[model samples]
Structure formats: structure tokens, C-alpha cells
Target: MLLVPRQLLRAGMTGDVPYYGGRFSPAQAYAAAHPQPRPAPPPPAPTSRADQQLAALQNLFAAGVLTAEEYQQFAARVTP
Candidate 1:
């Protein structure tokens, strides 16, 4: 069995006296003041005609529209 004083319980729930006796612990306050920078988005994909053709061939191969042999043959043409 456990018992909590009503006033203390109310204070804890209403943020009058948080678990840490403050709005946040030292570490949490520091994190709120200084957040890490987010990584930049990845570079845009290549848009050259050959690159586009190669990507299209890859999609077709993935969808089973082009056989492995056909994909390889078309890719060779696009790359060189």
C-alpha cells in the first residue's frame, strides 16, 4: 500500500513543483536552449538525357516490363 499527501500530489500534477522541482532538469533545459542542426536534404538527382534513360530502364526492369537481359542491353547503350 502507498499514500501520497493531497497537497504534494496536486502540486506535482499542476506543475507547481515538478518531479525535478523545476520546469525541466538541467540537461533538458540545455537541450531546449540549443538544438542540433538538421542535415541538409540530399542533392537533386542527375537530369541528363542518358541519366534519365538509364533511370527509366531501371524502373521498367523493376516493374518486370523489361527482362534482365533487355535492361542490361539498354543500359549499356545509354551509358556509353
Candidate 2:
């Protein structure tokens, strides 16, 4: 394994590494000045009133509060 001096490693980590002869690389300078833009995240899907009512009916059926027939009837009414 190649070994580097502790001071050199510290300077590199802290972004203060000295150029070979007081000169900055062109690519490094350009990259520091210009950064790419990130795209915005997509918006969340909106829930409809019918969807909320159906979900409530499903929860009731799952809890044994509503029979299959009643659940289906309520679901049908909740939707268009």
C-alpha cells in the first residue's frame, strides 16, 4: 500500500491541498464554479372522497363490524 504524509492527508480532507506551484487546475476551478441542477420530486396523488369512504368500509369489514353483503352495499353507495 502507498503511504501519504499525515499533513498532506489532513490538508486534502479539509479542501486546502496546495497546488504543485501556486496554480489551480482549470477543470477543478470550473467544476467548483458550476454545479448541475436537480429535478423536483413529483407531487403526491390526491385521494377522492369515494376512495376515503371505501377505505372506511374496508376497515369496518375487516374488523367484523360489517358483513360481506352490507360492506358491498355500502361500498356501492359510497362510489358513483
**How high is the lDDT of residue 78 in model 1?**
82
Lowest lDDT block of 10, candidate 1: 15-24
Worst 10 residues of 2 by lDDT: 17-26
Question: Candidate 2 lDDT (Cα, whole model)?
Answer: 0.85
Write out the backbone clash pairs for model 2: none
Q: Write the per-residue lDDT of candidate 1 for residues 1-80, one digit (tens) a residue.
A: 44988897788788894467546898899999999999999999775989888889999999999999999898988886
Off by over 4 Å in 1: 1-47
Candidate 1 lDDT for residue 45: 79
The candidate scoring highest on lDDT is 1
Q: Candidate 1: lDDT over CA atoms?
A: 0.87
lDDT of 2 by residue, 1-80 (tens): 54998887888897995556666688778887898777888887766877888998999999999999999999888877
- The alpha-carbon lDDT assigned to residue 66 of candidate 2 equals 100
